[model samples]
Target: MSWLPNADIALLKKRAVIIQKMRRFFIQRDLLEVETPSLSQAGVTDQHLFCFKTHFVGPEISERKPDPLGVPLYLQTSPEFHMKRLLSAGSGSIFQIAKAFRNEESGRYHNPEFTLLEWYRVGFDHFQLMDEMEQLLKLVLACDNATRLTYQQAFQLHLDVDPLSASLEQLKVAGASLDLGDVLDNEDDKDTVLQLLFCVAIEPVIANDAPCFVYNFPASQAALARISKDDNRVAERFEVYYKGIELANGFHELSDSKEQRLRFEKDNRLRQKNNLPQMPIDHRFVDSLDSLPDCSGVALGIDRLIMLATGQSHIDNVVSFTIKGA
Candidate 1:
């Protein structure tokens, strides 16, 4: 029946065990577990992410006229901003398994509402974060080995192109060769084309066998990651993939407030160009960046991880219910 949960009883029990093991893994590392609000006054400006909007009404009814429309709020897409604020306020090494909301996202590997396991490790860069992430995956997937590749290397090995030096025309040609179909339009950005090509051509080849950590993405794709000192064209970012499924995204947190503000403004500009709603910038989060320690953080998809662990083909199989089922 439509009222039934998507997951069976045994699957739900296994899900609970996975969650428990995850908590124990973090607790053993002394990473304090904390909870942050799932709703906020402002939402992320990232052009690719969309936040669900809502209104918060006051409890008082007999009092003076409360704004009938109520105060506008947004459901958080990630707990990253709030957690970073806590880190700036001197809360070192924290982790959270929280509910994150994203508008217009649902598929075999995605859901509008999903559980995220996010954490920060002070004094750790992207490499260190990857090591810790690998350890966590080992415990969950019961795997001992993982492959490592840089963004450049993966592209080179899989697609026979240099991701950094390749021109837009070259990328378009590569995409055409792969039969990706109409990858180039006058309006398409370079990074967008690269991503399209990467997804179809490169991603599967890298992690098809074992869990793989692909690091050092192009600087343009870096959301909050610091640019690499060794190579200005790359950012200190890494993503974890298992069996052709992307499971985690991590960054060496950027601490420069000015740069952070510039990135947010740039995101809004892109949003405006794409005719998407420009989100209100989180000024508090920007201010917190000034004091944010040199740390690394990651957001891992709980459902996708469970899908991989249990050999489930669809995300709905691991979760209790999909949004429609719920």
Candidate 2:
């Protein structure tokens, strides 16, 4: 068996250069660089995400009768909760290039442990954030001005269906042509079906050369984004796609503590319904939401950006080590 880094020297050098450039780009924009804890007492409750759990042993923890294993700590899937806490604490406009972990399938585009470039811009809405994202893409990838579309428009343009107003039956009918097999038939959740349709039918066919920004996702898929004031049916969320890869996800953040908690509970309920593991909600993070500033935040996949920058096809080609190599 061979033991070597997945990335060669040239690829490693290119990766370093890209990171340095990213730092410079953010620094010039006056966003403060900050670091948050990678391990937390609670994990994300999102049904779509899973956390890597580890045990924390204190000097006296092992002797406790109630628990045989030390306190369970979870490796954060994203630094979002911690960063938002910082924002709540009055840290204005911060950014982080940090390691994030997720327990999931790892392959061409995904790594269990990967670098993420996340930032929050105070007082900016989703549109303003999208504009800044375009500028950054121009600087880093040297791409042309991206075409913009609402989530509804993207679906209509590509699949000739109205995602925002479509009934569950209508969406299922639209998705039927994809021949996605039992996946579509078995899914009862409208949001799940819409997400699958977006991934399978739309993502591959989007602009392959320049970036594309799809905004105003359905409220059901809002996650942490605020629902649109003008239209309650959708949220102020946006996602950036470039070279047929999803590069960034951003939101005009929701600052309601109560609403946030309800969302978390909803996610756990969904997890229970699906027989997936229920994650402990980070109460500390939720509590901080009341003080969180009106801002926009986004998390960009650094490894994928590096892959696009260096003309690499697989994630492993841009990182020093793959999961197997590690």
Candidate 3:
């Protein structure tokens, strides 16, 4: 018998249909479909996300015939890093649907590996990208009226606090008062604290309703998005939520190489503080950043999108095969 439940075959067909429609949507818009290497020499400097590691062996490097230096590589958690590299090289607008992996994550909502749909729009701001995200969600669901909300508003409506402005102490207090789960060990880090609050307070509410976009994230938490000028306190970033599942993340691309370096260095510092191994910085990416166009980009989980579209609650239902069962 197939690992996937026979009933899910219908859902699988729907997933294929949506994926086909997505390619058509971008094609009609004149966006080029691109591919990037999955086995990369470096990793995202973000200290929180963990990636699965592998070793590359080749005779070319060490003349060992089959193996040399046991070259270390990682399964990409997202195609963002590589896709942005393309943008820096003047690829006007691009999109890709690819497989991504994350280590040490397994749950009803997570698998060690999953499908990712990512795209970039040149000469667009984050808000413009938000509008595009709405269109994409509507297209996938084949329905209109999907909801949208800012991060602050989502928190205020659900957690009763302004996440962007909340003090760490205030966040801790809020967490305790609400019987929210345990605080992150590094709650002093505002980004970490904000994430905790969002998970504890905002997530349940966002998940309970129709799909929504959590927009305008804190600047400190902006991994690769440009910081918002008006607020200086937040970055132009957003994540789409549906049926309690996070479906997509979008950013107004950060084009400054120096800033990107600063962020990468900061992330490395964080890794040292946490005793995690440091990853090599991708200098090629930094070089490209200098010439990178102003763009808005987003990544969607095709499987999760399928889950919502077909009303299948668990991620396993949409996947052809899952790690645990595989």
Please give the CA lDDT of all the candidate structures.
Answer: 0.90, 0.91, 0.80
Give the C-alpha lDDT of model 1: 0.90
Pairs that collide, model 3: 207-244
- Candidate 2 lDDT: 0.91
User: Which residue runs of candidate 1 sit more than 4 Å off their true CA positions?
Assistant: 59-68, 185-187
**Best candidate (score: lDDT):** 2
For TM-score, candidate 1 versus 3, the one ahead is 1
Q: Per-residue CA lDDT of candidate 3, range 193-269, in tens? A: 77877876677677455677788888888888899988998899998877667778889988898999988999999
lDDT of 1 by residue, 1-326 (tens): 88889988899899999999999999999999999999987899998899999877866433334457776679999999999999999999999999999999999899999999999999999999999998899889987578899999988887778989999888787677776555455536888888888888877777776799999999999899999999999999999988889999999999998999999999999999999999888888999999999999999999999998898999989988889888
Ranking by TM-score: 2, 1, 3
Which ten-residue region of model 2 has the weakest summed lDDT?
A: 59-68
Q: Higher-TM-score candidate among 1 and 2?
A: 2
